[model samples]
Target: MREEHVQDELGRLLAPGRVDATAALELLIRQALAMGASDLTIEPRADRFEATVRRDGVIVPLAEGPRDALPNVVNRVKVLAGLLTYRHDLPQEGRIPADSFGADLDFRAAIYPTSYGDRVAIRIFNPSHKDYELPDLGLDDETRDRLSAAVSRPEGVVLLTGPAGSGKTTTIYALLRHMLRMDAERRARRNIITIEDPVETLLNGVTHTTINEAAGLDFARALRSLLRQDPNVLVVGEIRDHETARAAMAAGLSGHLVISTIHAGSACGVFSRLLEMGIEPYQITGAVTAVLAQRLPRRLCAACGGRGCDSCRSTGFDGRLLLAEFASMSSDLAEGIRAHMRLQDLQAIALRQGMVPLARQGQRAVEASLTTEQEVRRVLADA
Candidate 1:
């Protein structure tokens, strides 16, 4: 459809009187996919309902409709997701299969009760998207090689650390796919199992499981059970709690190559985060292989020379590129962890051992004209 036609249709669907919620939602989803959005949020306001799509770590407004149309639209989404629409007093989450939308995409729907009304956020996943390969992740040669070496190990934990929406999950998935290809090339068959909250992608040779807290199945419990399944490689979605962290370490030490993601500010911060989780220092030194921290900075718009343009939504940026720092465990770094060294001391050790910092990578990107200094500063301000 043409741009003008799309705008007219959206206007009609969101008009004041009598709205077709189903058609309105379909348009929003189509628009989100077209914009390469990671999430679509429909929020309730006092006088109107607004829809926004998150594209490349930035949220942009998509549309707005009369407040009276929101409930019907929310109900339509709940029905599609197989959620309990009648219960608006509590939060609920469910999945909408790709086939339902006639697209190669997966939608995860989450609804929470708000003072104004129920707020809905839908995460869009394209299972067939192949842009997440290690070569295509925009990593420098040194960082990529270090990550490849770490994941090539037969036994150890490879952890990806970063804040939310920093592409940690994408990097981990790429690593897993690379491992699978390597195993195939070597004529080696390995059993790989993954425990994820929603099991985003469907890999052909991997066993994927999702966390079902309602069924008493969480990450910790699931990891403990999967250990007995004779998996050569285990992928825990995220190490959030003490039990899960310890379980992952045990799995790593027990000859299984464990891969996981954790929330940390930087590569060296992973150790401090694990220590704070109550994981023993010995386990940290023994089971961990490497920690790769990364961030997504918007790529400068080449077409407009960083000027506002229609191609870049007038944002002076087209998409995002990965900026990463990989910290491979060395004897000195291991000893520092064992000795309960301060975070700065450990970071210093990592730097001395040839580990690059995220700030330096950002500076490199800026110098290379891949991104703006302002963009890099905005992303790594906390790091």
Candidate 2:
């Protein structure tokens, strides 16, 4: 259909109420497709619905529309996603396709029923766009080289640690892509598997596993089962428990380059985190290889030429940069965590052992002033 016809159809499908259309939504969709968007949000209020698209570690508002008109928009989305009825009281998932800028777009839509009406969120995953390069993640040469080396190891553990909103998953995925393409001659036959409660990235080659919280498909059980299958490389989505920790340590020791992630601010913190989960100290020092802790910092968009403009919405930052904390096993931090030392003490010793702290990485962001002191302060705050 023509562009005007598509917009007309969408307008007609919407319920009768205040209608507001801006170029923002179009830009939002374009930006997300070009980069990668984890989720999309529509905030409904008394007067209007504010649409925000999260990209590059920041939330940018796309447009504002009449509140009464939102339900109609929600209805349209529901219909397009093939939902019989849409409820604003529970979580719902749906899929839809839309045409934009000459290309057909595929979107995975989810709606969560909220007090202020149904909040609509969408995660757009495109299978057709097969070309993904690790360097596209916007890593500098230094960080890129370090990350490449860490994941290329034959038999060791590399952990990506960060809080929930951090860029942990993105970093891990980059490393996984590296592994998927590491071999030059393409002669190596390797199996890459991931265990996630809800797998995010739709990778083609890797065998994806989902955990059944009730039926015992949890990480630990899954990891044990995975080992028996003799996976050449394994990825445990997150090390959330002692069993999973033990299993991952075992995977590392068995000469499989097990790449995993954790919910910690620093890489070295993984050792103490494992111990806190009840894994033995000796297991950590022997089996673990390196830890990668990271965060997503709001990045300045090169589009507006990094200058303040109405186009960029004046926040100056339009994208995100990855801030990482990599902890390699050292004679110091490894020995400290094994002895049940405080993370602070372990970090102090690890610093001397060449451990890279998040603060140090944050400082680089600060030096570029790509990030502010407040941003760094909030991120560096004690857990």
Candidate 3:
């Protein structure tokens, strides 16, 4: 749809005192997705309400509606998320599934009290997409082969590390699917379970549990409980603290294949993070199979042809491509780690053993025009 048409539709739907505010909000979400937005933010100011959508790593304002209509829109979202509309002092979070856009979408909704009114933000996740395959993530042939081999291990920890929004969870989901597809008999016998904060993506043949700190259900507590369930493959959404890291590492040692994500700059940096988390060196050496780090570089939009266009918001970039680096642990590397070798020395050995560094992978993406040098510099510099 044209931008003007979208604007007009929004204006009509958001007309003051409109009882169809829920329908208008749903239309707004569809329009945001059509504009290639990954996140939608609605802010209520003193005079009016402003809405913005995140596209290509940048936030662009979409529309502004009357302050009177803001409550109806926010309440509609609150009702959908099962949050209390009457309460305004405390923040609340909830989620609901919407298929109004002709796709299965899981929308996470949160509301926060403000000086003017309440603010609402919604994150959209599409669960029916099949683009989470290994080959689909922008991994080179050698790195892909090594990663596949790493996950094939019957019992070890495969950690995907990167900053936020770097596609770590998506990659982990892809790895899980890859493991299930490689063998039918194993899939039939093995039980796969995941403990995630929000359970972003849904997968068949896997049991997913969400984190509930309010009810005393957390990652560490759940890991200890799930250990008795005989889960062949365990997935921890993230290793954030000492307790969770210890539990995840212990699970790997006890003969379960553990897949998890951590926040780190490179594959080589994962060990330092684990050590900083107060985990023993030997525990990491024995159970770690591989560390894969990834980033999402904005791909040039086909509709723009690398030039400014309405479809791409004149940024020349639309979607993102995966740029990844991985280091698979070898016996020699593990031995050196056990011996308390210097991180640089261990990283050198990993590089010699076909491990690709993030810089190298990102450079390859730049050379292939999958992304630009400026973008690479920005991401690596941040790392």
Candidate 4:
């Protein structure tokens, strides 16, 4: 059946339009905006398109699409989102808004281009006006206080490391907000530059650049220019290449506080990942200050929340909190890196110097009852 022909005649208590593939697709997203669902998934199979909302770590099936109409539902979403012109063997992104909610969703979409049929996943980005507050990140007081001091430094690289959707970006935004509050008068007079792939958020009072390695407007060049601009603070979305890492060190050495994220499993892994990316151990030692690695787990629902239930959505989870591993640079760890020792060796030294691994952070959350042991094990296992 077509979306226009979808009947809202389902039982009142069963959730309206939930079984109608067409209307449910729209209704589910709209409901996500209404209920503040953080993520949405559309699973297209050989037999049907399974559309579900990820609320409080649970998969709530909103609608089931007929196999024959699977393409239509997927294509409609892409077309409506401005993601793609038509179905093809390529990946794309599309984002459209529902006027009723006045919410803008940023979709990081992909089409597998598989023989099983094109599979699409949509990760929503909800930019809240209040998203930049530090206290609002749901971090524990201990975690918050430690991170707060790291940001207080005058010159050094404060790295934020985590996997995608792990709230690393949120932590960055929150920290920036915290800085703006702490030294608004002083910060107002300083130059702050950022090099992000596709600038996620728009921060006031900062010079932001989008990275384009193909055009030579990459992080290395941007950092060099940002230094010339005499920035007091710097934010780089990702540091994967040697050039960017070198530039980051140069800036930090020249009295700028550099901030960036690396794709590492633990806070300690940040060092190894950097070395793997080709940064010399000495350069890595010279520029680092603190590494704050975190992951976002679902938060519990105060209402309709339970240990386990049909409505709990079968994931045995509710909402999310942060599992963080925070490690600050010390003289001993710096000496290990300077001596060209292995990252594993440096990590052991870091632990000896009071660095907390991210896995420990997750375990603390589990012990606090903020999340389940399974949730902790799922994320911390990588550490």
Candidate 5:
């Protein structure tokens, strides 16, 4: 359908009187998927309910409807997610399988109560689309080569650092797939295990497990137990706490090639974050192999030269490209960590040793006309 046609359909579906909440929600999700959105948000206000879709790291308005009809729509989503419909005062989360809508996508639903009404956010995942190999991630040649070399090591922690929704998990999965293919080529069967908060993708021949905090199975506990399973490569979804961070470092030092993601602004920031998590400097120096920091900048629309086009929803962006920097462990870097060197000094060493910053990567993209400078700045403003 054309852009105008989609808007017209949404307008009719979200019309004030006698709305079919279920049908409206279905249309919204279908439209979001068509736009390559990673998330859909439905927020209730005093007089109306607003919907937005996040695509290429930007949130664009979708539609709005009468406040009276929002409850029905929220209830429909709750029904699909199997959330408690009666409890609107508390926060709740649930999952809606693709089978519910007869689509090839999974929806993770979260509801939080506000003074006005309940707010609903849904994350869409297409697990069947597993093309996120290292090459597919759009890493520059040098960064890709560095990352591949880091992951090829037998026993060390290769950490991916980035903010939330920065595609860290996707990159980690790609690395895992790359390793699996390598193992196949060598005809060497190696044990690989992963522990995630929610196992997003189902990978064949790899042990994928999820943390159940309610069942006393958290990341730290899960890592301790998995250590006994003789895993050659361990993938921890994220290190969120002190215990998990300690366990991950220990695993790396104990001869397991550990791969994980952590919330850090840059490759150099990962060390400080780990130190803040109570990890000893010696442990970090001994166990960490590399840190890869990344971001996703919206690519400019080719159809309209970034001026605005119906094809890009008038956002001048059609898709996203990766901006990444890799910092590998070196003898000098290890010594710096052991000596408790400042982050700036450590970063200087990384630069001297041929590490590129994310800003430099973004500049390259801009020069190539792959994305706009404004978009790159927006994505890296915090950095």
Candidate 6:
């Protein structure tokens, strides 16, 4: 569609009281997609409703609607997501599979009660967006080779570690696509299953299961039954608790390739996270094949020449690139983990084995002018 056509449609949809509830909901979603937003936050206040959309890891103001027009928008969203519209006293969660925005998009919405009204947060996942390959994820040749080799193994766990919004999901999806491409006929004979809170990307020949906590089906429960289905490859969205971690470890040890994400500051920190989840260090060493930590730094707009320019939306930065650090469980690293070595000692061993640390990757990005030192520091300050 032409840019002018889209702008005209958006203007009509967002004409406040002119549109009904359904039209108002579509207006908000369409506006977000047009702005390339990853998330939308709508909070109801005493006199008005506030909206913000997250773009390129930064939150930008979207709109503030008059109090009268706000509830209709909220109600329309709830109805589409299959949540209880009459109740605003408790937290509610729902998902909507939508295509009105011209792509296959999944909307995960959550409503929570507050003093003023229900606050709604919606996460938008576009499966129709271009799929990425290994190189497209910005992995160096060596790191890519190591990860490819690890995933090629018959059975083991590969964990992608990073804080939220660090592109872990995208990396894992790319890896899965690569694996499927290696031998389509062989893969066709195998059962691949993914258990996610809300399955983001749609993969061919894979069973995607979204977690339903309200229905009493969570990661741990879903995984237990999934094992009976005899899957050759299993993907867990996020290993948040001890139960899910143990289930993933067991599935991996029992000859299923397991992939999952965890919240850790670095690859080495993944071991500590597993241990803190009540998993034994020896168990972690036995099940873990590799851990990859990734971050997304906003790349400087080439058209801007590192100065704020219209092409970059005047943010100085335009797009994003991957900065990754990884560690594999080689014999030495495995033994160290089994022996419960210090984190520093283990990291040193990996470094000697030619593993790149996050700081070095960030510095490389800075030198290449893909981003700035300030951007790197902001993304990796904890690392």
Highest lDDT, which number? 1
What is candidate 4's local distance difference test score? 0.69
C-alpha RMSD for every candidate: 1.6, 5.0, 2.5, 4.9, 1.7, 3.0
Off by over 4 Å in 6: 1-21, 100-103, 185-189
Predicted candidate 6 versus true structure: per-residue lDDT over 1-383, tens digit per residue: 33345445545655664856575566667777877878989888888777788877878776666666666777887887888889989998888767645567888899988887888899998774438887788798999998988888879999998778888888888888888887584644567899987788778878898888888999999998999998888999999999999999998888999999998888988887888899987778889999999898888989986788767667788778888998988889888877778888989988998888999999988887789998899889667
Inter-residue clash pairs, candidate 3? none
Residue range 204-247, candidate 2, lDDT tens digits: 67888888876768898999998888787888888887788888
lDDT: worst 10-residue window of model 6:
1-10
Residue-wise C-alpha lDDT for candidate 3, range 58-113, written one tens digit per residue: 67878887788888989888888889989989999988656644667778888999
Estimate, for each residue in 115-220, the C-alpha lDDT of model 4 and write its tens digit: 5566766666667723858888876687689788877788888898887767777888888878877778565555567788766677787677887776778878
Give the per-residue lDDT of model 1 (tens digit) for 1-383: 43456667877986777588889889889988888889999999998888898988988888777788889899999999999989889998989878766687889999999998999999998765544788888888888888898888889999998778888888878888898898999999789999998888878899999999998999999999998999999999999999999999999999999999998889999999999999999999999999998999999988896897888877899888888888988899999999999999999999998888999988998999989999998889778
The best-first sequence of candidates by TM-score reads 1, 5, 6, 3, 4, 2
Q: Predict model 5's lDDT versus the native.
A: 0.87
Residue-by-residue lDDT tens digits, candidate 5, 284-381: 99999999999988888899988888888788888788889899888998888878888899899999999889999899999999998898898888
Q: Which candidate's TM-score is highest?
A: 1
lDDT of each: 0.88, 0.69, 0.82, 0.69, 0.87, 0.83
Q: Candidate 6 clash total?
A: 0
lDDT of 3: 0.82
In model 3, which runs have C-alpha deviations exceeding 4 angstroms?
Answer: 16-20, 99-103, 185-188, 310-313, 331-346
lDDT of 5 at 3: 48
Better lDDT candidate (5, 6) = 5
Query: Between prediction 3 and prediction 6, which has the larger TM-score?
Result: 6
